[model samples]
Target chain A: MLRLHGIVGDRRDHALHHRLHHLEHHDAIEFLFVPEADLGRRRLRALTDRGTECAVSLDRDDALYDGAVLFIDDDRAVVVRAGAPRELRLRPQGTEGALKLGFLAGHLHWRVRFEGTDLCVVLDGAAADYTARIAPLLDDGIVTVVGNAN
Target chain B: MNAPALSPATPAKTAPAARVGIGGPVGSGKTALVERLIAAFAARKVDLAVITNDLVTHEDAERVRRSGLIDPARVSAVEAGACPHTVIREDPTLNIEAADDLERRFPGVELILIESGGDNLASTFSRDLTDFWIFVIDVAGGDDIPRKRGPGVLKCDLLVINKADLAPHVGVDLDGMIAEARRVRAGRPVIVTNCRRSEGIDAVADHLEREVLFRT
Candidate 1:
C-alpha cells in the first residue's frame, strides 16, 4: 500500500527520489492518468480502479502539462493527462463580435484562442458545454461550432 | 458587542519595492498610462522598474523599452500564454519571479509597475501581486462601462476614465459618465484624465505618493 503525495518537483530535496528509482525497477505496475481539468483544487484524487488515492500538491504556480507524472510506486503510478482537446469555434458577424466573444470566454474563465477569423475556446468539459450553454448567450449573427479542431 | 482587542506583534521588516498594477480592456489606454507613469515617476526622481504581460507578443514591452523614458533594461515582459487574467490573478508565479529578478538586479528600485495584458472587465490583479491597482477605461469604450459595474471597475483601488477629450466625439457626456461611476462606486474616488495632454495626471501621482508610496 503506497500513499502518493505531491509532485516530483515539489519534493526534489526529499529522500523519496531513491524510493521512486527503486520502485521504477519493479515489473508489476498500474498506471492512471488524471485529466488536467479534474485536477482542480482538490489535494487528493481518488483512483477508483486502484482503490487508492494520491495527494497532488504542486506549487501554486506550477503548470501541469500534458502527460505529467504525479506519482510512482512499486505497483502503481498516477499521471496528469490533458485528455482530448475539444474547442468551441465562434464566428461573429458584427465589428464587436470578436471582442465580445473573447471577453465572454475570459469572463467565464475559459482559455481563449484565435485562428485567423475564428475565436476558439478549449472547452471545459460539462462545466462549459458551450454548444448547449454559451451559444444562446450570443446575438443572432454569431455562429458557434463545438467539435474536434482537426 | 465590542470588537476583539488587537495585539501588537514584533517589529516588521521594511519591504523592498512597492508594486502597482494597471489593467483594462484592449485599446483602453493601459500602455499609455504606463508610459505616462514612467515619465511622471522619473520626473519626481522615484526609482522605478516595469514588468509587462503580453498575450502573445512582446510589442507592449518593446514599445516602452524604446520610448527612451527609462533604460530598456528596466523593463521586462512576461508572455501571458493567452490567459492574461490567470497570470495576474490565479497563478501569478511568473510575474512574481519576474519582479523578484528585477529587484535583484536593481536593488535601489523603489517601485515596480506591472501592466496586465489587454483583457476585459472581469480582469483584476491578485492581492499577492500588487499593493495597489488602477483600472483604466476610456470614453471610446462607451459610458455604459461604469454602469455595468464590472469587478475591475468596482474593486480597483482607483478607477481612471481616460480619453476624456474623446467624450464629445463619441457622443458621451463626460459628466454623466463620471457621475454614474461615482454612484456605482459608492462615492469612491474616480479620476478623469486625457493622457494625451497629461491632464489630471498630477492628481493620480499625488494619490500614489500619498496613499501607496507614503511620500508625505
Candidate 2:
C-alpha cells in the first residue's frame, strides 16, 4: 500500500494543468474519487482507479479539494476527484437577499458557487441539514429554491 | 489518556505537535497570559511555538517575538481581518495553516499555542484547530461574565479568570465569581491568575503539562 502524505499541487495551477493535459494523452493519470463529506478529512484510505491501495494522511490543516494532485512521477500521476455532492440551488430576490444569503452561507462555512444570479450550495451532508439552516431565508421569500431541494 | 506507542512493525512518523488555543475578549490579558506561558514553558524547557491571530495588525506577534522568551522565528501571525471569531470558529483554515507552517519549520516542537484575536465572550475555538483550548476572562470584565454562560466560558477545556489582583479594586467578589464559574461549568477546572505578578501561572502550566502534553 502506498502511503501518501500530502498534495503535490492543485490541478488549477497553470503548470500543473499543462502537466495533467500531457499525462491524459498517455493515460498515465489515475484518479481517486473521494466523497464531498470526506474532502475535509486529514486521513483517508482509498483505492486508485487501477486498484492501487493508498493510505492518505495529510497535515491537520490540509484539506483535499477537487483536482488535488496526490502523487505524480514522470510515468504516472494520481489525482483526487470529489464525488458528486447533493446541491441546493437558490435564487435570491435582489441585492439585499443576495447579501443575506451570502452571509448565511459564509457563517455556516458552506461550500458554494454562483452561476449567474443563482447560488449553488454543494452540501457536505444531508439536504435537510442544509435546508433547515436556510429555512428562515426561504420563509422570508428572500430566496427561493430553484429545483428539487435534494 | 496517553496514546499507545506505535508497534515496531509500523513505520515511524513524527507526531503532529499539540495545538492549544487561547481566546478571550479585548483587554482581557490574553497576550499577557501568552507572555507568561512563554516564560513558564521556557522554565520547563518545553519545545514550544506560538501563533497569534491579530485583528488588523501583528501587534501581539511582534510583542511575543520581541519578548526574548521564544525564538522570533518560532512565532507566526495570522491577520484575522474584521471578524475575529470567524477565523477561529467558523473557518479556521488560516490559523490551522499557520500552525502547520510552524510545525514544519520546527520539527521538534511539542506544542503550538494559538492566540485568537480579542473577541467577545461568545467566541470559541473550533475543535479542528486546537487539541485543548483555554478561554481567558478577567475579573475586571465583570463578575457576571461567567454567569452569562457564553460558549467560550462553557465550552472551553479550561477557563482562566485573569486579573485576580484587581478583584477587590474592581469591586468583584473573587470567591463568588469563581464559585459562579464552577457552578456554570458543572465543576470543570477554573484557575485565577494575576499576570502582573505571575500568580496562579504555575497551576495553569501544570494543567497544560498534564492534560495537553500528557506529562503526568
| Best model number under lDDT | 2
Q: Which stretches of candidate 2 lie over 4 Å from their true place?
A: A1-150, B1-13
Per-residue lDDT over B1-216 for candidate 1, one digit per residue giving the tens place of the 0 to 100 score: 111122232222344577788999998898988899899999999999999999889999999999999999999999999679999999998998998899999997878999999899999888667767899999999999999999999988789999999998999989999999999999977999999888878888887776556554
lDDT tens digits by residue: candidate 2, B79-104: 98878999988999999899889888
The list of candidate 1 runs beyond 4 A from truth reads: A1-150, B1-13
**Chain A TM-scores, candidates in order:** 0.41, 0.54
Best by DockQ: 2
Q: State the lDDT at B201 in candidate 2.
A: 92
lDDT at A125 for candidate 1? 55
What tens-digit string does per-residue lDDT give for candidate 2 at A1-150?
555667889988898888887865565666687877557555556676556656665667677998899876666677888985457899999988899998988777565667899888866458888879989988999998898457
For model 1, how does the per-residue alpha-carbon lDDT over A10-122 read when each residue is reduced to its tens digit?
Answer: 22335654554454344212234445543432222334223333333333334455445565544434444455555667776666666776666666545456777877765
Give Cα distance to truth, residue B146, candidate 2, Å: 0.6
